[model samples]
Target: MRLRGRKGIRESLEKQEDLVVLQPSLWKGRWSEYFGNSNPIHVELGMGKGKFISELSILHPDINYIGIDMYDELLRKASGKVRFRREEDGIGLDNIALALMNIQGIEDVFAPGELERIYLNFSDPWPKNKHARRRLTHPGFVNKYLSLLNARGEIHFKTDSRNLFEFSLNSFADLKLRMRAISLDLHSDGLREDLVPTEYELKFVSQGMPIYRCEVVVGQQSLEAHEIRLKQEGRV
Candidate 1:
């Protein structure tokens, strides 16, 4: 999922220093200080073109948002749309940040309990059974998310891939995680207020693909298990 050699991509990313974090590692555990607010942080993994998360920032100023992706080209495009008409306190989109990083390396950039919520919008289905673990909602990735989320944090996932969605549900159940908001035909559910359509989501919906959605929460048992893993990793 690499898109290189895009003209002005690097230049634009460099120019938007306030919006994009070239090196996110420096503020791994201290993101509150980076945003200069005690607001809870929410991150969108694989935020293609960044429209959904950017608009979410505007809607919820109390929650800081970060859009993470692997390509600077996409981030360059996202940086353009993420800008608001009048940023809060002239701080320049006060509650938003973009990071250039791979989804698999999320653990290296965000500490346990640092993120209040995570969004997986139209993630790669990774349809091959052998590559199932590579999917964001796979059991392995789910465990990583468990370690990253706060006590009450949850993951809001939306995708058009039926296999991926079903796999995610089964994975959450196997891990003893709490699941809610399970919807198959999202547009018909009358949960419009809760629906924030990503770029891919809109296209899929227009094509009549039933969008699958779910929210996975870290249950008490899973949280305790994650704590044990964190202690073993010396992260607790």
Candidate 2:
């Protein structure tokens, strides 16, 4: 969706040619060069309207963040938020960037061992069995994530759909991924104090819908095998 208000932010984003990567192939091996450092990188796929990523960037300025979304209309809104924060804070928030791209081409945008973490917030469930491949937790997408994630990289997922959560659990088990942290009802008062609530998570919780959350680690062996298979097939 097109962002409303903040015309100045829109203009600023228009001039920030280097901050937004429109080309997917160029992102494969140029992330460090683009960010000007080799600091840890984190990504949020399907960053809708920028609330979650923007807030996370503000919370953690030490690590670099990239918000990926294919819809230019929605990305423009996300861009406006990032630019506005940079202008208002005057803190040179250079750690954050936005990309107009799809998650299917994640490997094309990030080199091997590039990402430290990935966030999947409220992705479409694609509930039908025929559309299972489109689910973020599906084997196909998990393989794509394995291509760019570091050996111990973590994937954080939070969703309101029980079907998607169950499917993701099964997918991770089938893939033999080691899952450390798993929460079936994130809204419970017993939740860890360290948990950071995303925009969608907060809304869902307030509406009395229990959120599902989990963290999966990509082991060294799995990482190596994933890389070899991707290289052989030439896509992740």
Candidate 3:
């Protein structure tokens, strides 16, 4: 998913001071010092080209944002966008940062109970029975998120694929996560005016695809059960 003719973007990212390089193996427990704030932290996994998070950072200056993607080239493009916005508009978007890392290593990048919110925007469906474990909604990744999320944290998700949406719904239910809100078609009838469009979300809407969205709330009971299971499995 690397973009061609991105030399200018690469140079822009290199010049950006806000884009943080998060090497999971090295910065396992040092994110708090990097941000220098006890304020709530929000993360977007598989941030793609970073349209959603970049806009979000501009909209929410109080909350710190961390965008994660595995592709170095994609992140470079995303970082370039953020840098351009800051340079042109003097947006002072210092609260946002980009990390080149995989979601599976999320625990290694942030301390336990550090993230206040998580966003999953149009992640790869990995639509095969044999690849179920690779899906972001799978229990393995859910457990990882549970460990990192605060007590009242929530995970927001949006996708245009019905199969992936259905699979994620079932995975949340199986994990005992309560769905606080859901919209089968985000752009129809009455939609929130404050809703911002992601890069893929906008494309999907233009193509006549319905975007499904939901928020899952983490409960104390579910957290306790997760902790017990983790202990029993020697995960702690």
Candidate 4:
């Protein structure tokens, strides 16, 4: 949900510059340098409220994380969560960074093969047929992700919308991408200890909602196609 514009949202975000990356595109292809480590990078597209990313970063110190959100209010709120975790748990926030940007401009921030994994948690379904292209799981975005992920990289997607889940699976199939660990009801077997829940996810689970999830692996053919397209467009 989009929060109302709050006063000083920009100032609040700026105050957390240590955790919030400003002018992130300049660091494109140099995320490891920015993190001061060569650890694999995992990014959450549209990380709402930052619950999942912050908790995941705290759980795994060896891997780096970047949470992207377009709204200033959301990023501010997410920054607050990271701060609270750092103060309350006495843990370092070196492995995590929050970026305020739209997902469509993601290519300007990360180079090809720069990401180890991408997370899609409760993304906007854009249920209308005309707006399907705007869905995060659309083939256009998936192809961009394919170009960005390393050979072993994968996309972990979760949503409460059945239509969107099915649509994403079909889109993957059309691209001949391999999918694994699909769950129609993610919590039907009870929540797994390793699973991290987002703020919306927690609320959905509380309401007894069935969550859909899947992992999409990059196929060689798809990767080659992305490369060939990039070359054809003179972007490579």
Which candidate number has the best TM-score? 4
- For each candidate in turn, the TM-score is 0.87, 0.83, 0.85, 0.91
Cα error, residue 137 of model 1, in Å, equals 0.8
lDDT of 4 at 90: 93
The TM-score-based order of candidates, best leading, equals 4, 1, 3, 2
User: Against the unseen true structure, what C-alpha lDDT does each candidate score?
Assistant: 0.84, 0.80, 0.80, 0.90
Q: Which ten residues in a row have the lowest lDDT in candidate 1?
A: 83-92
lDDT of 4: 0.90
Decide which is better by TM-score, 1 or 4.
4
lDDT of 4 by residue, 145-181 (tens): 9899987688999999999999999999999987767
- Candidate 3 runs further than 4 Å off: 1-17, 22-25, 190-192, 219-236
**Model 3 Cα RMSD, 1 decimal:** 7.1
Residues 53-145 of candidate 2 have per-residue lDDT tens digits of 876787788888998988766777787777777677776657888887878878777888888889998999998999999998999999888
Q: Candidate 1 lDDT, tens digit per residue, 1-236? A: 66766776787788877889988988989999999988989999999998899888887889999999988888887887787533433545789999998878889999999988999999989899888879999988888888988865879899898898889999889998767669988987543666678888778777777989987767464456656876998976
lDDT of 2 at 170: 95
Rate residue 208 of model 3 by lDDT.
76
